[model samples]
Target: MKVSFLVSLFMLSSVQATLWGQDLITLDSLRLQLAKAPLAEKSSLYEQLAWEYRKSQPDSTIFYSDQSINLITREGLDRNIAKALNFKGVGFHYKGDNVKAFELFTSARDEALEHSDSLQYAHSVNNLGRIHLNQGDFFKAYGHYYKALAAFKKVGDIEGVAYAYKSLSELYQSQNNLSKALEMSQKTLKIRSKVGDIDGQISILVELATIYELMENYNRAFDYYLQAKMKAESIDDAIGIARINLGISQLYSVQGMNEEALSYADRALNTAATSGNENLTNQVRLQLAKALLSNGELTKAKNYLSKVVAKTAITRELPIEMDAYYYLSEISKQLGDLRDSYENFIMYTRLKEALVNAEAARRIERYEGRLEIEKKERENELLRANEAKNQALIERQRFQNIALIAVIVVIGVLLVSAWYIGSKRKQVNLKLQVKNRQIAAQAEEINSQNEQINVQNQSLQKRNRQLADLNNEKDTLMSIVAHDLKSPFNRVSAIAELFNITNLTEEQRTYVGLLRQICENGVGLIQDLLDVNAFEDQSRKLHKVKINLMDLFTNEVRAFYTEAQAKGLDVQIDVSELLYIHTDSSYLKRILDNLLSNAIKFSTAGKKVVLSAVEEEESILIRIKDEGPGFSDLDKTQLFKKFTTLSAQPTGGESSNGLGLAIVKKLIDIMGGEIILMSEQGKGSEFILRFPITNVAPVSAGSQ
Candidate 1:
């Protein structure tokens, strides 16, 4: 029975290896083709390379993605740009930068939506759902996944639908809803089978197997795992094979087949390492550790577990880390290292508790976010109701006024006719005089009504003027408040800077850092407030002058160099030595400063920020590009709105008062420059400022 069981497990594991087919082109083949390909073909090749390398070589994926992006930009291939961005985001996702991945997916989705490309849109949305699912935002994940399903269905995209179903299954499985996960996986399998997608079918089978495993249906799970492994092997998918081996190893370990588990674990580890996938290798190592520990190989198990633990710390895979710690504890206890065993146990317990607490906190945070969204929706509903009510009141008053005027005109016309008739009939009868007297009396009453109407109109005009004055007063008060607040904020910032320069104990330095951060945030908010007031002030005007573009860019770069360097960013400026433009020096400087600051603030360490300028015949074009988290579709709509923050947070923990871009836009407009934004969320963003050269003669050097 034991021999038969081990054989069945090995067969099942072998079948799992064929889930994903090998890439059509090898790395060398792709590189050779890329070298001689046409511009468009080269771009396509780069994108293909990015997709192929995303799983096993993330850095290479990013490099190829950048190559594709550069080519797409040169060719103005808007559609291909979205694909490159999506692939780049996939690279980030695999590299464990979920936030960056989410941003890139968002950007791709936006680009797809903009182009009305339903298939790409669905793909990006599905990816977004996966990100949210991994982040433990179940509601958000569900929302995006359903949206993706709808989009895919609308486009008649069978593949996209299957992908969405698979994602939904994984999400449900993560939530421990095995029944729903099984249902989703089965649906996905049905679709994939109908479409003759063997690879997709294999993936769904593995998912179903996992769900069954979680439910403790060992027989069913084993059966599905065998089917998946066979499908994977049929397609020659090395990664899929390794995944299956790992799964089988875990299953056998669970069944107390230590020797068989060890065999499969070693196979999986070797395959994963060969495939150059650190994530898979770590997973396989954990399984191997468990198998070895069960087989009484304490030292080998400890080594494997320790390596997994170290990698887990970097990957932030909490569950894997916890498992590694637990196993290490067991290994230590068996080796008579009681002290080490207790320490490992404590570490395991702490990590487990932290994971549980984090999950609970995330759930609470999500609930609160939902409540806030609901409250905003309610507020909007009320505002709409109030607007309707006000409109109705205005319409009613307008009709009433018109009716009053019509009645007055009729009364006047009748009185005039009566007077005329009475005058003509005066020669025919004595009663004519009495009628004239009544007409005269009516004319006097009409005159009195006219005076009253004029008085009411004057009163309305005065009230309108009063309302205008009140509005002005409100703006003035806000301006005063902002101006008054700015001084103290500046003082606090200056004081903090001075204090930061002095040495202190570690705890005191931390407190000083906090104080500095608070002061800086306050200063940023006040500056934004002041900018808002200035932007609304009609009296404020641009102070245009002949300025050197290179000088301005260099100064801004210098100002931001410390911050960027601290975060390990490379800020490069590529501009002509004497590039000059006629613009408002202060306003233009502000624009550059804000953009550079934002670029540095949002970018992760080891990324590059480039500032380049080109002199056109009629305008100076300046571009600032940063490899930071990009903006979402929703973010773009409100990008220049006062106090509007986007989904992405600054990597450096800088304060985003949401005023920087708004002010930059306003300043650009003041200088009569056109500002364009090009960004894909995960990749980075580029801000292009085109300032038209004025017809006025350049100021003399002496004027400076």
Candidate 2:
């Protein structure tokens, strides 16, 4: 519409959460309150600031969201944590880091679903729709938008419903379904006006204008653009006014009024620049360049286009970049700069293809193909149903014919009845033959599809084998690296420990202590690496024997006594005498050691860790409770993952290779035991393990 292939700016989807329904508190006031707020209230304050700063300062929004997440997670107040995550992803989305935004959005959605936070779930779902839309996956985008819209409606969130409606309108407009697009826009406008959202009303008006313009209804489009302009100017929204004017500029350019188009483009660019929103400023420049190109002002157009291209190096606007390169190539060639034109053309081609990658393109093709297949299948099903209905009708006719023959025999017309019956039988045989032919054709088609599926399955199997081989190589590499690094780390740790007895200053002693901690961390990492390889081996076997709980507890306590003492922590045992169980002693010892070390690692200097064992009805229960910073519910889900990074860090600067819990989980499974974590943030944590006293180990335990 604008003599270029650029996507409309209005088509970019907005996040579900905005300043709508927010409190009237200012950012400065929120920050001031945050400074003096107690720990319990700070998380909420941070969340408020995050929403407040979302539009004007995205980086600040991200920072505040991080602050809120940390506090809420630590305090075990998970109500607003998912919302904070959603807001953080919104920040990244605005900053044009779609990949990072997608990750955060997924996490937010998962967290919301886990906690049953319907509102946040809807927000996150709508935001995910926006990401998919921006990435040029229209089919997926539509599906996500529909899902979010339903969610919003289910939650009775009027604003969220409007957001999803507007998103759908934009998506429809992009795909050139102007009628449906207009309908969706009208729905959005009704909601906007009902809610008294003047800005939203203006946005919808411009969107309606864009759709009409694309429909070639220039007069109607112009009227809507003017209405949007009046509303934007009434509210003194500089950026909004600029966008409205830019739309008008495109309309003028379409009608070949180059002079008027250039005038409006200049005005829009000036207004956008004065608003201090450089992203909008650059976008207006792109449109301005198009107008100039249409007016045959090649040099001036090239200059404006160069500025737009420069902005793409910062935040990727694929559509804008693609269009800019396209125009640059054209302008360069017209200016007799053939080499420059060629270079720009190459870039234009690449960016165009990159807008939809090969993988996404294939997915879209498959989606369309599957839709077609489903349509045909539905048609076939209907055909079969109709044929069955016809057959039933024919069967009823056959019975009625038999009754007619009896009547004919009673009336002495046997010859006529026999002739009619023969004719009817011939017709039924013909219909049956046709039906059988159709069935044969259907079977052939199904056989072809089955062949295709078989080929696909074979391909999938090959890929899986390749992945397995890669995993094996990774394990081998990990073992080799661990074996190679263990000796060096041990030597470093030993040397650092020896320095504790030397005649050194306090500062030197502090350095030696830091060195010792580093060495210990390295050794821990190496050990964990080897453990990963061991746990992944299916042939790794477990040896079961009788294990006394008191002896095991005493030995574990003595082993970690020095480590606990160094951190100024106390370890207590609460096991009765003569406590015994039949299981792999080495497996149990490793599990106890790992849990104890973790308890000590996370406990503060004055906190105490309690380890106790008690006999239950069918099993023995073991509890390792720590009076330290406890884990959040979210953290509990990640406890047994290999090398999972969690919200809580080790207290006293102790290191965790993130493999101990994973190994412990594996060993417990092999020995026929169950482990559960009971924890609350800022309170304390307890790990409970249950094992059957008699016949504990499973039959397969000896096999691995």
Candidate 3:
């Protein structure tokens, strides 16, 4: 539910003044301190006030930050200037003026570096990293974060190190490396706990909970969420409380505990409203709407969803806005408001597409901005270098004029010295000419080597093109064979079927059976070949749709049930009542067909073939276990290779061209799924297919 990473810049510890019960008291204390304190001290207090007001009052933050900056400038307090600049940048950052924030942070970083203030410099660097991270410049953001971490470590700043860890955790989470994210979050949590930083610990706990939730460790996630909620309650952090409640609600909603989910959603909504945070309010409202909708409370769900939609129209929160429209559409459909449902659905689709396009544009803009910044920096460097060179040239020219004046005073002596110098210069020129000739010889040799390399490269290119052509021709031939040869085999089988086997001799019946068997085997082989070709084709794409795994598995297994029965093999299915997945139905069918066929083919008489599906936190595992002659070690090594026959033969004289598993592997890869084989020579084989649960509805029994 909490997909975005927590920006470290926003995770400021509560000031001591705020602990005294009221913002007004904190403001009075700050103003009193400013009025009585000296100019130098006033700047520090002003910065403190800026920090205090940052979350609640952006204008106040900017005003205090400016006051601090002005006083620091007048007092020539260079060391504190970067802090003020950083505070001002935070104000702009919160106000969504990222460009201005970037400029201020850059200046702050430069000023801090100039004064050798490692701690301040790291803060500015971290802030810049946050900006880049938000802009989707992961590489640049990573570089800045690493630099900040090193700087913080150099200064032995525990708080800075903790923040850097938290930022890195967020970065890893963004990359979907949940394991690394958990590691970093834990590291940060340890530091926070050691320092008794309750606010920081609360943030880290929520992060850890979210990560565990994503990993499907629901119990652990719930424990962490409860801990975070207790901590937030102890501190009377309404916003934090709201966040924890929302997380819990989402967890329960996903688990289909609608009653508990609705309870938490209501609690979160109240807390968010008390906190007076519109963003948090909207988020909780959306969660509440989902819970209400799930419970069939159409009127209440519509009320909450409509509020969020109206709020998001002004906030332009694309993700929540889209969700609101989507849920509204669902609610409308449930209430039998067909026109409204259709309209809301259209809006949802339009917004979703717009958000995707906007994200793509933002990425492009970030890259372009980075390039422009680098180009400008390079130009500035060149200008500075040219200025230095010009200054040096002027000094050199001044020295030359002085030397000329001195030489005029001793013109005759200089002429004699010049003659001696000219003789040495001529000797040097002769040696230079000899060196030039040697350089020319080396250049010629290099050019000849370059020519040979070019010739080899051209030859390799030609050979590569020929190989590509051969591969294309092979694919074309396979396609032709699959299409052209299948018809003839079908026609032969039909003609053979027309013959009356009862009137024929025993030998004729045997020949007729053999012909039909050959046709079936030939057709299967050609289809396999075509599947292999299709798998290799780059243009082939998956047409993903929401499908119930139980339905698909049952249908596929039923198709081969009769064949299995003929072989004296019992086919069994152990699957959930309803398990949904977003995948290409045809491709998934092929995968199931191959695995099921192979199981039935190799399974001996009186053996059982079991197909089972189990849902994990983040993925689903579909296992096909067969009591067959398991693969040998060598056969396992070459398994899933196209057209490579292994030691295992079909039990019922069924055809095995060794392309089934290969096609299965390819399809799994295309679907972003994984296949794992667990087998032993004497034991049965279990083929486990794992597909990540993505873009699919939650698993629910008897739900469409």
Q: Which scores better on TM-score, 2 or 3? A: 3
Residue 449 local lDDT, model 3: 100
CA lDDT scores, all candidates in order: 0.81, 0.82, 0.84
lDDT tens digits by residue: candidate 1, 169-270: 767766667899899899999999999898778778887887898798988988998898898899877788789888888888888999989998898887
Rank by TM-score, descending? 3, 1, 2
lDDT of 2 by residue, 1-704 (tens): 31011133422433112212233458769878988999998887887787777765779889989988998888898876889899899888777566677778878987899899998898898888777666566777788899889998998999889999998887777677789989999899889989999978987898789789989999999999998889888877676778778889989989999898999899998887776566677778998899889889999999999998998767687778889999999999999999999999999999989976843564464456445434544765798799989999999999899999988787776677788889999999999999999999999999999999999999999999999999989888888888889888889889988989999999999999999889888887888778767866779677778676888899999999998999999899998766777777878888998999889988889899999998888889999999988998888888899988777788877777788899999888887899999999999899999987674433243431
lDDT of 3 by residue, 525-584 (tens): 998888888788879788988887788878987899799879988888898776778889
The predicted structure with the larger lDDT, 1 or 3, is: 3
Question: How does residue 480 of candidate 3 score in lDDT?
Answer: 80
lDDT of 1 at 53: 80
**Would you list the clashing residue pairs of candidate 2?**
none
User: Residue 551, candidate 3: how far off, in angstroms?
Assistant: 98
